[model samples]
Target chain A: MFLRIDHVGIACHDLEAKIAFFESTFGMTVVSREVNEEQGVREAMLHVADGPNGSSYIQLLEPLSPDSPVGKFLAKRGEGVHHVAFGVPDVAEAMGELGGKGIRLLDERPRHGSMGSSIAFLHPKDVGGMLTELVQAPPPRT
Target chain B: MFLRIDHVGIACHDLEAKIAFFESTFGMTVVSREVNEEQGVREAMLHVADGPNGSSYIQLLEPLSPDSPVGKFLAKRGEGVHHVAFGVPDVAEAMGELGGKGIRLLDERPRHGSMGSSIAFLHPKDVGGMLTELVQAPPPRT
Candidate 1:
């Protein structure tokens, strides 16, 4: 099951400029920025506000390659929301539950996501044209 | 200032089917359902999960007429995300701030939204093709 919304992924042509826009225009905070080579994007997370589920973030993603998924999304849709990620207690468990439900899974196993979280995506075509991601936060350090 | 993500507005041709999908597929709860004649849409808010800011919703919208905004969106873009609503203390104040900042607002004054929330929209053309909404919740009952 889902715990809360993890973040909303926004595709951008210029990550820094988008970050500046959100900061100056919306008064958001840039909490972290990192490059996920596997996902083929450089991304930044903007802290929207504190919530009961925790602090929800708006993730700005700039594709590292034109052939990447985010890059293709940008090319087709221009710049906009690429996906909505929901926070789950466990990605593997959720995947197991969703399997064979007529929903297509993008990953067979949990993969690394931004901020050390586990992630898996559901095909947009299978989920009403919205690319949805299931996210599980990395276990806290002992 | 924004508090959290209030809801993600999703355009749908069949409101009941979409509501059922969220309930069975995502296991979300239907918190409220209303018809806003002014907005020309029948909408149902699905509670995704509780969070620190309170709770976030997935709002399913079905147009009342073919000429309505939601209807136009469905006709052009098919079923998908319509807008992302961010929770604000006051929508009018946010409009004032966003005005003349290259962001064009759809509402000059706060308009009646589903569940008595005051809502305003920012044009997608001005915001990188992503329609954004500012929403203020209805005041609690005495």
Candidate 2:
């Protein structure tokens, strides 16, 4: 089941510039930055505000390679909101349920995603043309 | 300053269908529904999860007229996410600060928005091609 909105992914050609805009205009700060080679994106997560479930993040994603998925998205759509990720209890379980309900999924199985979470993407066509990602956060440290 | 993300505006051709999709898929319930003639859209707000600031909503917006802003957006871009609205303490003050910083605002002044909030939109070109809205909630009743 869905828990809360984890982050809203924004596709950008320049991560630093986008991060700077958010920081200067909205008073947000980048909490973490990393190159996700598997996804072919250099991403930075900006801390926005605290929620009851957790803190919300504005994720800035810059494509590393032109052929990468994010790269294709940028070339075709230009820079904008790419996807909305919802925090769930378990990614695999959520995917299974959605698939069982005849929903099309880009990821039939959960895979590693940014910020130590397992993530699966639902197809845009099936979700009113919005790229929706289901994310399950890693277990809390003991 | 932005307090938190209030909702993500989703443009849909059929408000009821989109509402049903969210209800069945995410187990979310509609918190409120209304038609704003000025905006020329029928909208429904669904409660997703609670945060420290407040609950985030998935807003379904269906244009009432083909010439409406949302209608134009749908005809050009198809159904998908429209804009992201951030909760602010004072819409007027926020507008002044952003304007003073040279941000191109679609709404130079706060205007009446759905759900009893004063809202202003920032141009997409200035914010990495993402249309952003600043919202000030109605004061709490005594």
Best by DockQ: 2
TM values, all candidates: 0.96, 0.97
Worst 10 residues of 1 chain A by lDDT: A48-57
Any runs in candidate 1 off by more than 4 Å, and if so which? Answer: none
In the predicted model 1, the residue pairs found to clash are A51-B52, A51-B53, A52-B51, A52-B52, A52-B53, A53-B51, A53-B52
Q: B29-142, model 1: which lDDT tens digit per residue?
A: 898999998889999999876655556888999999999999999999898888998889888889998895778988879998867789999988776578999998889889
Q: Give the Å error, residue B36, model 2.
A: 0.9
| Each prediction's DockQ against the real complex | 0.71, 0.78
